[model samples]
Target chain A: MHESASTQTNPSPRVQRAPQQPKTADAYVVTPAIDVYEGAEELRVFVDLPGVAADGLDLDLDKEVLTLTANRAARGRDRAVTYKRRFALPREVAAENVSAKLEDGVLLLTLPKRAALRPRSIKVTSG
Target chain B: MWSLLHNDTMKLFDAFERQFQDSLAVRRADTAISFLDNGDELVISADVPGMKQSEIEIMIEGEFVTLRAERKPGAFEGFKLSRAERGAQKLVRQIELPCRIDAEAVRAELKDGVLTVHLPKAEGAKPRRIPVKASA
Candidate 1:
Protein backbone atom coordinates (compact mmCIF):
# COMPACT_ATOMS: atom_id res chain seq x y z
CA MET A 1 0.00 0.00 0.00
CA HIS A 2 1.12 3.52 -0.69
CA GLU A 3 1.92 5.84 2.21
CA SER A 4 -0.41 8.75 2.74
CA ALA A 5 0.51 12.16 1.33
CA SER A 6 1.02 13.50 4.84
CA THR A 7 3.67 10.88 5.51
CA GLN A 8 5.55 11.79 2.38
CA THR A 9 5.46 15.47 3.23
CA ASN A 10 7.33 14.99 6.52
CA PRO A 11 10.99 14.20 5.89
CA SER A 12 13.86 13.67 8.31
CA PRO A 13 16.14 16.67 8.71
CA ARG A 14 19.11 14.53 9.79
CA VAL A 15 21.82 14.25 7.17
CA GLN A 16 23.86 11.10 6.48
CA ARG A 17 27.57 11.32 5.73
CA ALA A 18 28.93 9.54 2.70
CA PRO A 19 31.17 6.52 3.24
CA GLN A 20 34.86 7.27 3.01
CA GLN A 21 37.25 5.62 0.59
CA PRO A 22 39.31 2.74 1.97
CA LYS A 23 42.93 3.47 2.75
CA THR A 24 45.92 1.52 3.98
CA ALA A 25 45.09 2.58 7.54
CA ASP A 26 41.56 3.76 8.08
CA ALA A 27 39.44 4.20 11.19
CA TYR A 28 35.67 4.35 11.10
CA VAL A 29 33.01 4.59 13.74
CA VAL A 30 29.75 2.64 13.47
CA THR A 31 26.76 3.51 15.62
CA PRO A 32 24.33 0.75 16.54
CA ALA A 33 20.55 0.91 16.41
CA ILE A 34 18.72 0.98 19.71
CA ASP A 35 15.39 -0.33 20.96
CA VAL A 36 13.92 0.60 24.31
CA TYR A 37 11.22 -1.11 26.35
CA GLU A 38 9.71 0.28 29.52
CA GLY A 39 8.45 -1.90 32.34
CA ALA A 40 6.73 -1.14 35.59
CA GLU A 41 9.99 -0.89 37.54
CA GLU A 42 12.74 -0.82 34.94
CA LEU A 43 13.72 0.21 31.43
CA ARG A 44 15.44 -2.22 29.06
CA VAL A 45 17.65 -1.07 26.17
CA PHE A 46 18.67 -3.31 23.30
CA VAL A 47 21.43 -2.07 21.01
CA ASP A 48 22.48 -3.71 17.77
CA LEU A 49 26.22 -3.35 17.48
CA PRO A 50 27.68 -6.06 15.31
CA GLY A 51 31.31 -7.25 15.60
CA VAL A 52 31.75 -5.88 19.11
CA ALA A 53 33.03 -8.13 21.87
CA ALA A 54 31.67 -8.27 25.41
CA ASP A 55 34.79 -6.84 27.00
CA GLY A 56 34.83 -3.76 24.79
CA LEU A 57 31.46 -2.38 25.84
CA ASP A 58 30.99 0.16 28.63
CA LEU A 59 27.89 1.50 30.35
CA ASP A 60 27.87 4.67 32.41
CA LEU A 61 24.99 6.14 34.37
CA ASP A 62 25.15 9.56 35.96
CA LYS A 63 21.98 10.45 37.79
CA GLU A 64 19.30 10.19 35.11
CA VAL A 65 21.69 10.07 32.16
CA LEU A 66 22.79 6.79 30.62
CA THR A 67 25.68 6.55 28.19
CA LEU A 68 26.59 3.51 26.12
CA THR A 69 29.96 3.26 24.46
CA ALA A 70 31.55 0.31 22.69
CA ASN A 71 34.62 -0.48 20.58
CA ARG A 72 33.80 -2.98 17.89
CA ALA A 73 36.14 -4.83 15.55
CA ALA A 74 34.95 -6.06 12.21
CA ARG A 75 34.58 -9.84 12.07
CA GLY A 76 37.48 -11.85 10.66
CA ARG A 77 39.53 -8.75 9.97
CA ASP A 78 42.09 -6.60 11.72
CA ARG A 79 40.31 -3.31 10.90
CA ALA A 80 37.62 -2.22 13.37
CA VAL A 81 34.99 0.45 13.93
CA THR A 82 33.71 2.06 17.15
CA TYR A 83 30.10 2.82 18.07
CA LYS A 84 28.66 5.16 20.70
CA ARG A 85 25.13 6.03 21.78
CA ARG A 86 23.63 7.90 24.70
CA PHE A 87 20.21 7.61 26.27
CA ALA A 88 18.40 9.89 28.68
CA LEU A 89 16.89 7.73 31.37
CA PRO A 90 13.24 8.70 31.89
CA ARG A 91 13.52 8.32 35.64
CA GLU A 92 16.30 8.27 38.19
CA VAL A 93 18.04 4.93 38.23
CA ALA A 94 20.46 3.11 40.49
CA ALA A 95 23.72 3.74 38.70
CA GLU A 96 25.63 1.30 40.84
CA ASN A 97 23.33 -1.64 40.20
CA VAL A 98 22.76 -1.15 36.45
CA SER A 99 24.22 -4.03 34.41
CA ALA A 100 25.03 -4.69 30.74
CA LYS A 101 25.90 -7.69 28.61
CA LEU A 102 26.90 -8.22 24.97
CA GLU A 103 25.63 -11.23 23.04
CA ASP A 104 26.19 -11.78 19.32
CA GLY A 105 26.96 -8.11 18.72
CA VAL A 106 23.83 -6.95 20.57
CA LEU A 107 24.23 -5.13 23.85
CA LEU A 108 21.43 -5.36 26.38
CA LEU A 109 21.21 -3.01 29.30
CA THR A 110 18.81 -3.11 32.23
CA LEU A 111 18.29 0.04 34.28
CA PRO A 112 16.58 -0.52 37.57
CA LYS A 113 14.52 2.23 39.17
CA ARG A 114 15.82 3.73 42.37
CA ALA A 115 14.30 2.37 45.58
CA ALA A 116 12.51 5.62 46.31
CA LEU A 117 11.16 5.90 42.76
CA ARG A 118 9.48 2.50 42.79
CA PRO A 119 5.75 2.76 43.36
CA ARG A 120 4.49 1.35 46.63
CA SER A 121 1.17 -0.39 47.12
CA ILE A 122 -0.40 1.11 50.20
CA LYS A 123 -2.48 -1.13 52.46
CA VAL A 124 -5.97 0.05 53.33
CA THR A 125 -8.06 -1.22 56.24
CA SER A 126 -11.84 -0.82 56.28
CA GLY A 127 -13.19 1.18 59.21
CA MET B 1 -14.55 -11.82 -20.99
CA TRP B 2 -10.81 -11.99 -21.72
CA SER B 3 -10.54 -8.17 -21.65
CA LEU B 4 -12.03 -8.05 -18.16
CA LEU B 5 -9.40 -10.49 -16.85
CA HIS B 6 -6.63 -8.44 -18.43
CA ASN B 7 -7.87 -5.27 -16.69
CA ASP B 8 -7.85 -7.03 -13.30
CA THR B 9 -4.31 -8.18 -13.87
CA MET B 10 -3.21 -4.64 -14.70
CA LYS B 11 -4.79 -3.37 -11.48
CA LEU B 12 -2.90 -5.96 -9.45
CA PHE B 13 0.38 -4.95 -11.02
CA ASP B 14 -0.29 -1.32 -10.28
CA ALA B 15 -0.92 -2.13 -6.65
CA PHE B 16 2.35 -4.04 -6.44
CA GLU B 17 4.24 -1.18 -8.01
CA ARG B 18 2.87 1.27 -5.42
CA GLN B 19 3.84 -1.06 -2.57
CA PHE B 20 7.39 -1.35 -3.84
CA GLN B 21 7.73 2.43 -3.98
CA ASP B 22 6.51 2.74 -0.39
CA SER B 23 9.06 0.21 0.83
CA LEU B 24 11.82 2.10 -0.90
CA ALA B 25 10.70 5.37 0.66
CA VAL B 26 10.87 3.94 4.17
CA ARG B 27 14.31 2.42 3.56
CA ARG B 28 15.84 5.83 4.21
CA ALA B 29 18.09 6.04 7.30
CA ASP B 30 16.24 8.80 9.14
CA THR B 31 12.48 8.12 9.45
CA ALA B 32 10.39 9.45 12.33
CA ILE B 33 7.95 12.42 12.32
CA SER B 34 5.04 13.25 14.58
CA PHE B 35 2.21 15.81 14.49
CA LEU B 36 0.07 16.90 17.42
CA ASP B 37 -3.23 18.77 17.07
CA ASN B 38 -4.37 20.55 20.20
CA GLY B 39 -7.60 22.58 19.81
CA ASP B 40 -5.77 25.81 19.03
CA GLU B 41 -2.17 24.75 18.62
CA LEU B 42 -0.25 22.32 16.41
CA VAL B 43 3.01 20.59 17.20
CA ILE B 44 5.31 18.83 14.78
CA SER B 45 8.00 16.43 15.99
CA ALA B 46 11.06 15.46 14.01
CA ASP B 47 13.76 12.96 14.96
CA VAL B 48 17.32 14.16 14.64
CA PRO B 49 19.43 11.51 16.27
CA GLY B 50 23.13 12.19 16.71
CA MET B 51 22.70 15.87 15.91
CA LYS B 52 23.54 18.82 18.14
CA GLN B 53 21.00 21.60 18.61
CA SER B 54 23.35 24.17 17.16
CA GLU B 55 23.48 22.38 13.79
CA ILE B 56 19.72 22.48 13.26
CA GLU B 57 17.81 25.29 11.57
CA ILE B 58 14.12 25.89 10.93
CA MET B 59 12.61 28.33 8.47
CA ILE B 60 9.06 29.30 7.65
CA GLU B 61 7.93 31.10 4.49
CA GLY B 62 4.32 31.76 3.71
CA GLU B 63 2.65 28.36 4.21
CA PHE B 64 5.78 26.28 3.79
CA VAL B 65 8.05 25.07 6.60
CA THR B 66 11.57 23.65 6.24
CA LEU B 67 14.08 21.97 8.50
CA ARG B 68 17.83 21.57 7.92
CA ALA B 69 20.75 20.09 9.84
CA GLU B 70 24.37 19.12 9.26
CA ARG B 71 26.27 16.10 10.56
CA LYS B 72 30.01 16.21 11.12
CA PRO B 73 32.49 13.37 10.60
CA GLY B 74 33.79 11.39 13.55
CA ALA B 75 37.38 11.52 14.92
CA PHE B 76 38.43 8.00 13.99
CA GLU B 77 40.86 8.02 11.07
CA GLY B 78 43.53 5.54 9.86
CA PHE B 79 44.21 2.06 11.28
CA LYS B 80 42.18 0.54 8.45
CA LEU B 81 38.64 1.07 9.73
CA SER B 82 36.28 -1.78 8.96
CA ARG B 83 32.81 -0.40 9.58
CA ALA B 84 31.78 3.05 10.67
CA GLU B 85 28.22 3.91 11.59
CA ARG B 86 26.39 6.65 13.44
CA GLY B 87 27.36 10.33 13.50
CA ALA B 88 25.86 13.59 12.35
CA GLN B 89 24.89 13.90 8.68
CA LYS B 90 23.30 16.71 6.65
CA LEU B 91 19.53 16.57 6.17
CA VAL B 92 16.77 18.87 4.82
CA ARG B 93 13.02 18.39 4.61
CA GLN B 94 10.06 20.69 4.00
CA ILE B 95 6.27 20.67 4.31
CA GLU B 96 3.49 22.88 2.93
CA LEU B 97 0.57 23.71 5.19
CA PRO B 98 -3.03 23.34 4.07
CA CYS B 99 -3.91 26.58 5.87
CA ARG B 100 -2.02 29.74 6.69
CA ILE B 101 0.07 29.64 9.88
CA ASP B 102 0.81 32.46 12.32
CA ALA B 103 4.56 32.71 11.97
CA GLU B 104 4.99 35.18 14.82
CA ALA B 105 3.33 32.80 17.23
CA VAL B 106 5.58 29.87 16.38
CA ARG B 107 7.76 28.20 18.99
CA ALA B 108 10.24 25.34 18.74
CA GLU B 109 12.13 23.15 21.21
CA LEU B 110 14.82 20.49 20.89
CA LYS B 111 15.12 17.93 23.64
CA ASP B 112 16.16 14.28 23.90
CA GLY B 113 16.98 14.12 20.17
CA VAL B 114 13.51 15.22 19.15
CA LEU B 115 12.60 18.61 17.67
CA THR B 116 9.13 19.94 18.32
CA VAL B 117 7.68 22.99 16.58
CA HIS B 118 4.54 24.66 17.81
CA LEU B 119 2.45 26.70 15.36
CA PRO B 120 -0.71 28.52 16.19
CA LYS B 121 -3.42 28.99 13.59
CA ALA B 122 -4.07 32.52 12.35
CA GLU B 123 -6.98 34.39 13.88
CA GLY B 124 -8.99 34.16 10.66
CA ALA B 125 -8.31 30.44 10.39
CA LYS B 126 -9.70 29.83 13.87
CA PRO B 127 -13.42 29.39 14.43
CA ARG B 128 -15.37 32.47 15.50
CA ARG B 129 -18.82 33.38 16.81
CA ILE B 130 -21.10 36.20 15.51
CA PRO B 131 -23.87 37.61 17.71
CA VAL B 132 -27.36 37.77 16.23
CA LYS B 133 -29.87 40.52 17.20
CA ALA B 134 -33.69 40.32 17.12
CA SER B 135 -35.31 41.78 14.00
CA ALA B 136 -36.73 45.36 14.47
Candidate 2:
Protein backbone atom coordinates (compact mmCIF):
# COMPACT_ATOMS: atom_id res chain seq x y z
CA MET A 1 0.00 0.00 0.00
CA HIS A 2 2.88 2.32 0.74
CA GLU A 3 4.89 1.49 -2.37
CA SER A 4 3.12 4.12 -4.41
CA ALA A 5 3.65 6.75 -1.74
CA SER A 6 7.16 7.26 -3.02
CA THR A 7 5.97 7.60 -6.60
CA GLN A 8 3.10 10.02 -5.93
CA THR A 9 3.53 13.72 -5.28
CA ASN A 10 2.46 14.33 -1.73
CA PRO A 11 0.92 17.72 -0.99
CA SER A 12 -0.23 16.71 2.47
CA PRO A 13 -1.46 19.86 4.23
CA ARG A 14 -1.37 20.95 7.80
CA VAL A 15 -4.59 19.74 9.35
CA GLN A 16 -7.38 21.49 11.15
CA ARG A 17 -9.91 18.83 12.21
CA ALA A 18 -13.61 18.33 12.81
CA PRO A 19 -13.76 16.11 15.88
CA GLN A 20 -17.47 15.70 15.54
CA GLN A 21 -18.43 13.07 13.02
CA PRO A 22 -21.34 14.11 10.82
CA LYS A 23 -24.60 12.31 10.16
CA THR A 24 -23.89 10.07 7.20
CA ALA A 25 -26.26 9.42 4.28
CA ASP A 26 -26.39 6.85 1.50
CA ALA A 27 -24.71 8.14 -1.63
CA TYR A 28 -22.57 6.90 -4.48
CA VAL A 29 -19.53 5.22 -3.01
CA VAL A 30 -16.01 5.16 -4.40
CA THR A 31 -13.04 3.48 -2.80
CA PRO A 32 -10.20 5.90 -2.22
CA ALA A 33 -6.61 4.71 -2.53
CA ILE A 34 -4.97 4.19 0.84
CA ASP A 35 -1.53 3.69 2.39
CA VAL A 36 -1.04 1.98 5.75
CA TYR A 37 2.18 2.15 7.76
CA GLU A 38 2.89 0.51 11.07
CA GLY A 39 4.99 2.44 13.55
CA ALA A 40 6.26 1.50 16.97
CA GLU A 41 3.53 3.43 18.77
CA GLU A 42 0.80 3.81 16.18
CA LEU A 43 -0.57 2.88 12.80
CA ARG A 44 -0.71 5.60 10.17
CA VAL A 45 -3.40 5.09 7.58
CA PHE A 46 -3.55 7.57 4.74
CA VAL A 47 -6.57 7.68 2.44
CA ASP A 48 -7.29 9.75 -0.63
CA LEU A 49 -10.70 11.34 -0.32
CA PRO A 50 -10.68 14.32 -2.60
CA GLY A 51 -13.74 16.59 -2.62
CA VAL A 52 -14.98 15.64 0.86
CA ALA A 53 -15.45 18.52 3.26
CA ALA A 54 -14.84 18.30 6.98
CA ASP A 55 -18.55 18.28 7.76
CA GLY A 56 -19.16 15.42 5.40
CA LEU A 57 -16.51 13.10 6.82
CA ASP A 58 -17.25 10.34 9.37
CA LEU A 59 -15.09 7.82 11.22
CA ASP A 60 -16.29 4.86 13.25
CA LEU A 61 -14.27 2.28 15.14
CA ASP A 62 -16.02 -0.87 16.22
CA LYS A 63 -13.81 -3.28 18.12
CA GLU A 64 -11.19 -4.29 15.56
CA VAL A 65 -13.00 -2.77 12.59
CA LEU A 66 -12.56 0.71 11.19
CA THR A 67 -14.98 2.26 8.76
CA LEU A 68 -14.55 5.72 7.29
CA THR A 69 -16.98 7.62 5.12
CA ALA A 70 -16.87 11.04 3.57
CA ASN A 71 -19.28 12.67 1.16
CA ARG A 72 -18.28 15.03 -1.63
CA ALA A 73 -20.93 17.53 -2.58
CA ALA A 74 -21.18 18.35 -6.23
CA ARG A 75 -19.34 21.61 -6.50
CA GLY A 76 -20.28 24.22 -9.10
CA ARG A 77 -20.04 21.85 -12.04
CA ASP A 78 -19.76 18.25 -10.87
CA ARG A 79 -21.86 15.42 -9.43
CA ALA A 80 -21.77 14.51 -5.74
CA VAL A 81 -20.35 11.21 -4.58
CA THR A 82 -19.44 9.45 -1.33
CA TYR A 83 -16.10 7.81 -0.49
CA LYS A 84 -16.04 4.78 1.81
CA ARG A 85 -13.40 2.35 3.00
CA ARG A 86 -13.42 -0.41 5.62
CA PHE A 87 -10.51 -1.98 7.41
CA ALA A 88 -10.50 -4.84 9.90
CA LEU A 89 -7.50 -3.94 11.98
CA PRO A 90 -5.25 -6.95 12.44
CA ARG A 91 -4.03 -5.80 15.80
CA GLU A 92 -5.91 -4.15 18.63
CA VAL A 93 -6.01 -0.36 18.71
CA ALA A 94 -6.74 1.89 21.66
CA ALA A 95 -9.97 3.55 20.64
CA GLU A 96 -9.41 6.58 22.83
CA ASN A 97 -5.92 7.12 21.45
CA VAL A 98 -6.97 7.38 17.83
CA SER A 99 -6.57 10.72 16.09
CA ALA A 100 -7.59 11.73 12.58
CA LYS A 101 -6.92 14.72 10.38
CA LEU A 102 -8.18 15.51 6.89
CA GLU A 103 -5.59 17.42 4.92
CA ASP A 104 -5.37 18.29 1.28
CA GLY A 105 -7.28 15.32 -0.16
CA VAL A 106 -5.89 12.66 2.14
CA LEU A 107 -7.33 11.46 5.44
CA LEU A 108 -4.52 10.69 7.86
CA LEU A 109 -5.42 8.47 10.79
CA THR A 110 -3.18 7.66 13.73
CA LEU A 111 -4.31 4.65 15.66
CA PRO A 112 -2.18 4.26 18.74
CA LYS A 113 -1.31 0.74 19.75
CA ARG A 114 -2.99 -0.63 22.84
CA ALA A 115 -0.92 -0.63 26.01
CA ALA A 116 0.03 -4.29 25.68
CA LEU A 117 0.73 -3.97 21.97
CA ARG A 118 3.44 -1.32 21.98
CA PRO A 119 6.96 -2.73 21.72
CA ARG A 120 9.01 -1.97 24.79
CA SER A 121 12.80 -1.90 24.92
CA ILE A 122 13.88 -3.89 27.96
CA LYS A 123 16.72 -2.37 29.97
CA VAL A 124 19.75 -4.67 30.27
CA THR A 125 20.60 -5.09 33.98
CA SER A 126 23.93 -6.58 35.01
CA GLY A 127 23.05 -9.27 37.45
CA MET B 1 37.00 32.67 -7.53
CA TRP B 2 35.67 31.76 -10.98
CA SER B 3 35.57 28.04 -9.99
CA LEU B 4 33.45 28.85 -6.92
CA LEU B 5 30.87 30.72 -9.02
CA HIS B 6 30.79 27.94 -11.56
CA ASN B 7 30.14 25.38 -8.81
CA ASP B 8 27.25 27.46 -7.48
CA THR B 9 25.73 27.75 -10.94
CA MET B 10 26.08 24.01 -11.46
CA LYS B 11 24.35 23.31 -8.16
CA LEU B 12 21.46 25.60 -9.10
CA PHE B 13 21.15 23.94 -12.47
CA ASP B 14 21.03 20.48 -10.87
CA ALA B 15 18.26 21.59 -8.50
CA PHE B 16 16.23 23.00 -11.34
CA GLU B 17 16.73 19.86 -13.36
CA ARG B 18 15.44 17.68 -10.49
CA GLN B 19 12.37 19.87 -10.14
CA PHE B 20 11.76 19.57 -13.84
CA GLN B 21 12.04 15.79 -13.66
CA ASP B 22 9.59 15.66 -10.78
CA SER B 23 7.00 17.63 -12.71
CA LEU B 24 7.48 15.41 -15.72
CA ALA B 25 6.97 12.30 -13.61
CA VAL B 26 3.66 13.71 -12.47
CA ARG B 27 2.63 14.69 -15.96
CA ARG B 28 3.30 11.30 -17.39
CA ALA B 29 1.60 9.36 -14.60
CA ASP B 30 -2.03 8.41 -15.11
CA THR B 31 -4.32 10.10 -12.64
CA ALA B 32 -7.98 9.78 -13.47
CA ILE B 33 -9.76 12.92 -14.71
CA SER B 34 -12.88 13.97 -16.62
CA PHE B 35 -13.46 16.95 -18.88
CA LEU B 36 -16.96 18.08 -19.77
CA ASP B 37 -18.12 20.97 -21.90
CA ASN B 38 -21.40 22.53 -20.77
CA GLY B 39 -21.94 24.83 -23.74
CA ASP B 40 -21.11 27.95 -21.76
CA GLU B 41 -18.36 26.53 -19.62
CA LEU B 42 -15.77 23.80 -19.46
CA VAL B 43 -15.91 21.61 -16.36
CA ILE B 44 -12.89 19.62 -15.26
CA SER B 45 -12.76 17.06 -12.48
CA ALA B 46 -9.49 15.46 -11.35
CA ASP B 47 -8.65 13.12 -8.51
CA VAL B 48 -5.52 14.30 -6.75
CA PRO B 49 -5.27 12.07 -3.73
CA GLY B 50 -3.01 13.04 -0.84
CA MET B 51 -2.53 16.61 -1.95
CA LYS B 52 -3.46 19.89 -0.28
CA GLN B 53 -5.15 22.91 -1.80
CA SER B 54 -1.98 24.96 -1.53
CA GLU B 55 0.01 22.25 -3.33
CA ILE B 56 -2.05 22.37 -6.48
CA GLU B 57 -1.07 24.41 -9.52
CA ILE B 58 -3.60 25.34 -12.17
CA MET B 59 -2.15 27.05 -15.21
CA ILE B 60 -3.97 28.26 -18.27
CA GLU B 61 -2.31 29.49 -21.45
CA GLY B 62 -4.52 30.25 -24.42
CA GLU B 63 -6.66 27.12 -24.95
CA PHE B 64 -4.53 24.81 -22.83
CA VAL B 65 -5.02 24.25 -19.12
CA THR B 66 -2.69 22.24 -16.92
CA LEU B 67 -3.27 20.64 -13.51
CA ARG B 68 -0.43 19.67 -11.18
CA ALA B 69 -0.24 18.28 -7.63
CA GLU B 70 1.88 15.96 -5.54
CA ARG B 71 1.26 13.05 -3.19
CA LYS B 72 4.27 13.16 -0.89
CA PRO B 73 5.71 10.05 0.71
CA GLY B 74 5.93 9.68 4.47
CA ALA B 75 8.86 8.16 6.39
CA PHE B 76 8.83 4.43 5.76
CA GLU B 77 12.35 3.74 7.02
CA GLY B 78 11.72 0.81 9.35
CA PHE B 79 7.98 0.40 9.20
CA LYS B 80 6.51 -2.67 7.58
CA LEU B 81 3.86 -2.22 4.87
CA SER B 82 1.09 -4.82 4.77
CA ARG B 83 -0.54 -4.05 1.43
CA ALA B 84 0.71 -2.61 -1.85
CA GLU B 85 -1.44 -0.53 -4.19
CA ARG B 86 -2.03 3.05 -5.33
CA GLY B 87 0.90 5.47 -5.14
CA ALA B 88 2.51 8.47 -3.51
CA GLN B 89 3.40 10.37 -6.67
CA LYS B 90 3.31 13.74 -8.30
CA LEU B 91 0.23 14.09 -10.53
CA VAL B 92 -0.04 16.26 -13.64
CA ARG B 93 -2.79 16.47 -16.21
CA GLN B 94 -3.73 18.84 -19.03
CA ILE B 95 -6.71 19.53 -21.26
CA GLU B 96 -7.88 22.07 -23.80
CA LEU B 97 -10.99 24.15 -23.10
CA PRO B 98 -12.29 23.83 -26.70
CA CYS B 99 -12.77 27.61 -27.10
CA ARG B 100 -11.24 30.64 -25.49
CA ILE B 101 -12.58 31.31 -22.03
CA ASP B 102 -12.80 34.27 -19.69
CA ALA B 103 -9.76 33.36 -17.69
CA GLU B 104 -10.41 36.03 -15.09
CA ALA B 105 -13.89 34.64 -14.40
CA VAL B 106 -12.76 31.08 -13.83
CA ARG B 107 -13.51 29.30 -10.56
CA ALA B 108 -11.89 26.26 -9.00
CA GLU B 109 -12.23 24.29 -5.78
CA LEU B 110 -10.73 21.16 -4.24
CA LYS B 111 -12.96 18.91 -2.19
CA ASP B 112 -12.41 15.37 -1.00
CA GLY B 113 -9.58 14.48 -3.41
CA VAL B 114 -11.20 15.98 -6.47
CA LEU B 115 -10.29 19.26 -8.16
CA THR B 116 -12.98 20.97 -10.16
CA VAL B 117 -12.51 23.93 -12.48
CA HIS B 118 -15.21 25.92 -14.18
CA LEU B 119 -14.20 28.13 -17.06
CA PRO B 120 -16.84 30.34 -18.59
CA LYS B 121 -16.91 31.36 -22.25
CA ALA B 122 -15.46 34.72 -23.16
CA GLU B 123 -18.11 37.45 -23.28
CA GLY B 124 -18.03 38.00 -27.03
CA ALA B 125 -18.04 34.29 -27.73
CA LYS B 126 -21.17 33.59 -25.72
CA PRO B 127 -24.28 33.09 -27.87
CA ARG B 128 -26.33 36.28 -27.88
CA ARG B 129 -30.02 36.17 -27.06
CA ILE B 130 -32.12 36.70 -30.15
CA PRO B 131 -35.84 37.61 -30.08
CA VAL B 132 -38.30 36.87 -32.90
CA LYS B 133 -40.62 39.70 -33.99
CA ALA B 134 -43.94 39.30 -35.81
CA SER B 135 -44.40 41.36 -39.00
CA ALA B 136 -47.85 42.98 -39.19
Winning model by DockQ: 2
- Reference contact recovery of candidate 2: 0.49
In model 1 chain A, the worst 10-residue window by lDDT is: A15-24
lDDT (10s digit) by residue, model 2, range A4-102: 654355554212223342322334546666666766666677777766778878888877556787777765444566666666554446776789998
User: Which digits, one per residue and each the tens of the lDDT, describe model 1 over residues A1-127?
Assistant: 2346755675842222222323213545444555544444555565655445567676767665555666644322234555555555443456667788765445667777677765568799999
The segments of candidate 2 whose C-alpha lies over 4 angstroms from its true place after superposition are A1-26, B1-32, B36-40, B104-107
Off by over 4 Å in 1: A1-127, B1-29, B77-81, B128-136
Best by lDDT: 2
Query: Model 2, range B48-136, lDDT digits (tens) per residue?
Result: 76667788899999989998887667667756554334566786777876788999999998765677889998977776789989988
DockQ (CA atoms), all models = 0.02, 0.19
